[model samples]
Target: MSKLRVGVIGCGSIAQFRHLPEYAASQEVELVAVCDIVEDRVKEIANKYGAKAFTDYKELISSGEVDAVSVCTPNYLHAPISIEALNNGLHVLCEKPMATSQEEADAMIQAAQKNDKKLMIAHNQRFVRSHQLARQLIESGEIGKIYSFRTAFGHPGPEGWSVDGKDSWFFVKEKAYIGAMGDLGVHKTDLLRYLLGEEIVEVGAFIETTAKEFADVDDTAVCALKTESGIIGTLAASWSYTAKEDNSTIIYGEKAIIRLEDNPAYSLVVQYTNGETVNYELGKIQSNDEGGQQTTHVINHFVSAVVENKEPLITGEEGMKSLAVILAAIKSNETKTIAKVFE
Candidate 1:
């Protein structure tokens, strides 16, 4: 099989750390081109990867050097770039939140449908081994009838992660659209849907920018969410975790309680009401800490889907559903009331 020609559109931390390296490692992919508004960054990545570099994404998309592209730009540029790439006949692996609004998400979905291209969102949390095990246990009825849950994703903020550090686009409201909710909350929203096999139907949120001094976007957010089946939960996303990061989820069910990433020795643990216990020794979830290891399953999945002419697990529609929950949460924060999802 001929290798799929791949292009990366952003030279930021995510692209450098995840997309580009993964693409280079994949024998099924050829790093054919790269684009970024920053000429130096794009040129450096291009030289290292032996691909052409372009300052204009439009030029790269129209250059016909790539069959697929990874949209790793800022949140605001995600929709337009992915849609444009799809319209230009390139399969897209877009970095999440998906879009700033439901309208943009819908447009991206429509573009992919219209062009008959695959559009996958990079929701990497679903690819974690622990998360997969949790989903399997839930589906197998090991955890009977989930009742409530609490999931949180927090860290010491993006300044430590982004390539631009404190001045990163992540803190800019115009570029980021939403802060903690968009950057971290959307991952949980997608993960919850993937793990529970249920859609978030409503949300009530409290959002604030209490920690970061320069950020116009919220540095912390807590959302109360209800699934379609009436399962309620609190999802928290924060950038104020200065001392320690928390990427934990606890699910309460009639049969057992399943905890994920709550312990260092065991990544998943289930304690049953019948006095039985099960411990899963899956490896730790990826963190922003230096030297932390994370599987590149999302990149592999996207490439495999493109090479085999199959749909990705996180399709455009699936991504849009996840985005809807976050959008609802934002609305809930704005109006100080519960907001209906996908309304």
Candidate 2:
């Protein structure tokens, strides 16, 4: 097979730092087109990657030269662009949270199914080597019957991080929807689900807009989750944390407790029931922060899935699962009760 021709939508921080660089670095992929609502940003990145530039993603997708496209646009545009690309016979790699609502997520999934094209969500946490190893340990019963866990993804606000700063669409309720829950919370929800190997069954959450000025979204959020297999846990996501903490997860079981962090070295730390403590630091695979190298991993997986006709670690359906948890958190915050997820 020839090199996969790729198009990138949204020339934002994520595209610049995560997907675009990885695509440019990938030997099996060709960065063919770049799109952004801001013409200058599109032009700049396209020139850097030596690709065609467009203000309209629709034009980029229809270029007929793209074998696969990465939907790096805002959360709101994820469903629409992914659906269009899939329908146009291009494989799609969309950013996280899948969609703001299940309806939109369902539509994206149906579009991929209808078009018979691959649709993957950029849930990079699943690609972390430590996360992969953690899953193996838990599944192998090395931890013995899992009972509970805690996970969090927190950092300072997006002002300096996002392209638009305080004016970024992320702070706008109309554009980004549910704030930190959608931004960081969804990642932890997905990570926990990946490690536990179970779908979330119920969620009770509290989401707040505590720190940022006029921020319509939650800066800090927390959720209690029950897994389909009866494991219970808590997940928290915050952009309001004063000191940065890369997203972290801790799992407790009959035999030991495991701690996993996605940075420095993606590592697993085990404190055994026998009073022995051991830390297995997994080597880093790519550049990553709180978002980790998962972005590069996800991009790599998307391209491989496109080329190999295989399923992605984070498929469109799996993306929806993570979104379901976030929506559950939102609903729980609203109703002040536990919301059932897959029920």
Candidate 3:
């Protein structure tokens, strides 16, 4: 079978570390082009992979050298690049927080639908082995009814992860639109929805700009969220975890409690009401730390979806649902009240 030619429309940390590398390693896709506003960065990445480089994403999209694209750009550019790619008749694999707002997300979805192309969001949490297993356990009634959950995705900020370091657009309110909440919080929102197989209906949050002096956006956010099924939970996101990363999730269920990415020895642990305990060595969740899981399941899954001519596991509409929850949380923080997620 002829491989799908892919262009990654951002040479940032995510593209360098996850999307580009994963595309090169895939058997079903070819890394054919790369784009970034920084010419040097794009050229460097493209040279490394023997792919074409473009400073402007629009040029790359119109180059017609790629069958698909990975929108690894910053928060604000997600919708624009993705919608452009979809309208150009290319499948899109966009990074998390698919858009800065619900309207943009809706536009991206509409573009994909109008073009009859697949648009997958890179919510890698749903692809984590422990998360997948946890979803299965919950679906099979192993954990019984879930009462609550607390899932956090905290790290030492984008300075440590982005290629541009502290100067990354993640610290800019204009470019990023939101801080850690948009960067990390959206992942947990999507994860919780996936694991519970329900939509987050409401969110209340306390978002603050207390950590980085260089950032104009909130560096920390703690939110209270409720699923459509009446499950309540807390979601925390921070760029102030200066020492280390904390990516953990704990779900409280009636028959058993499911703990994910909490223990280094075991990625998942479950304790039953009958005093039975099961530990699963599903491996650590993906992180920027050295020796962490090297490959992201996002690129592979996207390739498979395009190759099989099927919709991805996380569609633009699903991504829009997750983004709606985050937007509600932001609204809740601004208004100091619970905000219902817009359907």
Candidate 4:
């Protein structure tokens, strides 16, 4: 089969570190075009990848130079760009938090269904080797029934990771919508659901802008969540962990306690109630702070889904469900009460 031509929208940090490199590395993909509002950044990326650069996403989408696109833009543009690309009969791999609202997310799903195009969301947490193994263990009843979990994703902040640093769109409400919750929290929400095989049903949260100067959005958020299967847990997302990142999850089960990314060297560790222990060294989990040559398994999965004509592991509907949890948490914070997740 011919290589799948690809265009990437937004030549930002994620595009630079994850999308572009992964797509370029894939034998099934041809990086044909790139779009970003910043001319210099777009030019640099396009030149590096030997692709055309555009300042406008619409032009890139309509140029007919690619078969699929990776939307790495701000949260607000995710839905519109993805819907447009799907309407134009192009498969879309969108960055997370699918959209700022459920309505936008629904519209995106509708567009993909209407156009019969694949719409995959970049919830990279689901692709982590440790996370995949955790799901397997849980499914195989090795952990028995999961009773609770505590998952956190905290870092120094996006300023250090985004192309524009502190002045990036991540700090702006109109562009980003939600801060740490959308940026980091939604990832854990998705992963927990994937690992537990349950949908988050309710949320109680305290989301505040306690840190990060000049940022109008929340810099810290702690959510109390309950899944459909009666599992309860705490989900914390923060940009205030200036000392170091804390991207870890601990699952409490009937038979054992499963720890993920808790220890520096071990990716997963299980402590059984019978005083038995199992350690797994599945390498490090990829992080925005520690930018390295790590395989997220996102770009390759997207490319394969398109090439092999299979549904992506993280589909539009699944993405929307995860987005709903964050949205519900946001509402929980605003109302100072438990919020029910939208179905």
What are the clash counts of all predictions, listed in order? 0, 1, 0, 0
Residue-level error in angstroms, candidate 4, position 91:
0.4
- lDDT (0 to 1) per candidate: 0.93, 0.85, 0.90, 0.93
lDDT of 3: 0.90
* Model 4 stretches with alpha carbons more than 4 Å out: none
Q: Sum up the clashes in candidate 3.
A: 0
Candidate 4, position 94, lDDT: 98
What tens-digit string does per-residue lDDT give for candidate 4 at 228-252? Answer: 9889999999999998899999999
Where's the lowest-lDDT run of ten residues in candidate 3? 288-297
**Cα lDDT for residue 123, model 4?**
95
Kindly list the per-residue Cα lDDT of model 3 for residues 85-202, writing each as its tens digit: 9989999999988999888998999999999999999998888999999999999998998999999989888888777888989999888999999999999999998999988898
Ordered by TM-score, highest first, the candidates read: 4, 1, 3, 2
Across 1-343, the per-residue lDDT of candidate 2 in tens digits comes to: 5899999999988898888989999999999999999988888888999999999888888889888988877888889888899999999999987888999999999999999999999887788778888899999999999989999888887876888889888898887887988988888888888898889989999998888877887899988899988888888888887665557889999999988873454377888999998878676543334453344577888888988999988888999998998887888889888899855
Better of 2 and 4 by lDDT: 4
Show pairs that collide, candidate 1. Answer: none
With candidate 2 superimposed using the best TM-score fit, by how many Å does residue 174's alpha carbon deviate from the native?
1.0
TM-scores for every predicted model: 0.98, 0.95, 0.97, 0.98
Which residue runs does candidate 3 get wrong by more than 4 Å?
291-293
**Residue-wise C-alpha lDDT for candidate 1, range 1-343, written one tens digit per residue:** 7889999999999998889988998889999999999999888989999999999999999998899999999999999999899999999999999899989999999999999999999999898899999999999998999999999999999898889999999999999999999999999999999989999999999999999989999999999999999999999999998988899999999999999999889999999999988899987787777544465688999999988889999999999999999999999999999999988
Q: lDDT of candidate 1?
A: 0.93
